[model samples]
Target: MTTPPRPWPGLFISFEGIDGSGKSTQARQLYESLRSGGHDPLLTREPGGSPGAEEIRALVLQGDPDRWSAETELLLFTAARRDHMERAILPALQAGRTVICDRFADSTRMYQGRGGLRDKVDALHDLMIGIDPDLTLLIDMPAEAGLARAKSRATDEERFEDFGLDLQQRMRDGFLALAAAAPARFRVIDGNRDMDSVARDVHATVLRELAPSS
Candidate 1:
C-alpha cells in the first residue's frame, strides 16, 4: 500500500517594539538560537519581504517627508504585510520552517492607531483579519529612552520614528494594552534590561511555549 504524504510542521513568532527596544536584535538572537538548536527557522521582516513588499517598503520609508499621511502609511504597511504573508511567511511555514518576523500587524495597530490616527485603528484591524502570530514579544521601553537609542543609531529617521514624543508614548501604551489582552500569546519584555538578560528571557519563553502543557 502507498503511504500518505507527510505534512510540514511549523511555528510563527513576531517581535514588536516602539524604538530603541532592541527587538530586532533579540529576534535575530532567537532565530540563531533556534537554528543552533536544530530547528528549521526562517528569519524575515515586514514591509520588505517579497519583491512587491520591498517596493512598498521603499515608498513607505523613503518617501518625501511631507508627502505622506497617517492613513496612507498604514495602508502601505498592510499591503506589504498581505503580500509578505502570501508569498513568504505562509509558504515557509507550510514547508516546515519556523518563521520569525521582526514586525507585523501589531506594529500598525500600535503606531498608527495610538500614535495619532486613533480612528483608523479599526480599519487597520480589518486589513489583518486572518493573520495572527503564534507568539508576539513586546519589548517595552520608555518613549524618551527608545527615541534616544533610535536616534543614536539612525543617521536619518523615518517618518513614523520621527513623530513626536507623545505619539511614541501612546504607541508604547498600545503594545502594553495588546499584551494585557492576550497573556498567552503576548510576552512583554522590559527593554531597559541588559541585552544578555533580555535574550535569556526570550530563550526561556520560547522553550516554555514549545513544551507540552501540564
Candidate 2:
C-alpha cells in the first residue's frame, strides 16, 4: 500500500494508468481546471521533471527495448525521480503549490518492478525516494483499446509501448491491483468513454479532494 505524502500544505495529485489510458490528458485537464478555479497548480511529469532527469529520460525511453537491462533501467529511473523530487516536486510542495504530476513512483512500480524485481524496486524507493502522491487518479480501460490508442501516434519513446498487447494487458491488471491495494489513495476512473465524460469524472474527483480546505 502507498503512504501519505510528507506533511506539506500543497496538495499532491498524480495521474496513473497503462499507456494510452488518457492519463496524461486528464492530468493536463485537471491542471487547467485548477488554474481556472484560481488555484496555483504546477504541472509536471516523471522520469523527466527536472533538467537532469530529462537527460535520463531519453536514455531509457528511446533506443532498442533491449538497450538496457531492467535493473539498469530501474536505477536510471530512480535517479531521475530523485533529481525531480529535489529540484522540482519538493520545492513546489514546500511553496504550498499544488503539484500536478502526470506520473510518479507508481510508474516505476509498474514499469520496472517486473521479472521478480518488485522487492528491489520497493527497497530502493524507500531508501532513496520515499514519497507518494496524496491522491492518484488511475484512468482504466481495456488493454486492447489502450494499446490501439497508444500505437496510433507512437513516437521514439515508443520503446515501452512497443512491448505490444500482452504487456499492456499485464500492466492494466497490475495497475488495477495496485489501486485495489491502496483504495484510499487511488480513484479509478473509466477511460473508455468520450474524453469530455472522462474529464468530468476526473475534475469532480479532484474537486472533492480539494474541498476540505482549497
Best by TM-score: 2
Clashing pairs in 1: none
- In the range 76-115, model 1's lDDT, one tens digit per residue, is 8878888898899999979877888998888877765644
| lDDT of candidates 1 onward, in order | 0.80, 0.91
**CA-only RMSD, every prediction:** 4.9, 2.7
Residue range 68-173, candidate 2, lDDT tens digits: 9999999999999999999999899999999999989998899899889999999999999998899999999999999898899748788988899989998899
Candidate 1 stretches with Cα past 4 Å from truth are 1-8, 115-129, 155-157
TM-score of every prediction relative to native: 0.87, 0.96
Q: Give stretches of model 2 more than 4 Å off.
A: 1-6
lDDT of 1 at 79: 80
Displacement of the residue 98 alpha carbon in candidate 1, Å: 1.3
Task: Report model 1's TM-score to 2 decimal places.
Answer: 0.87
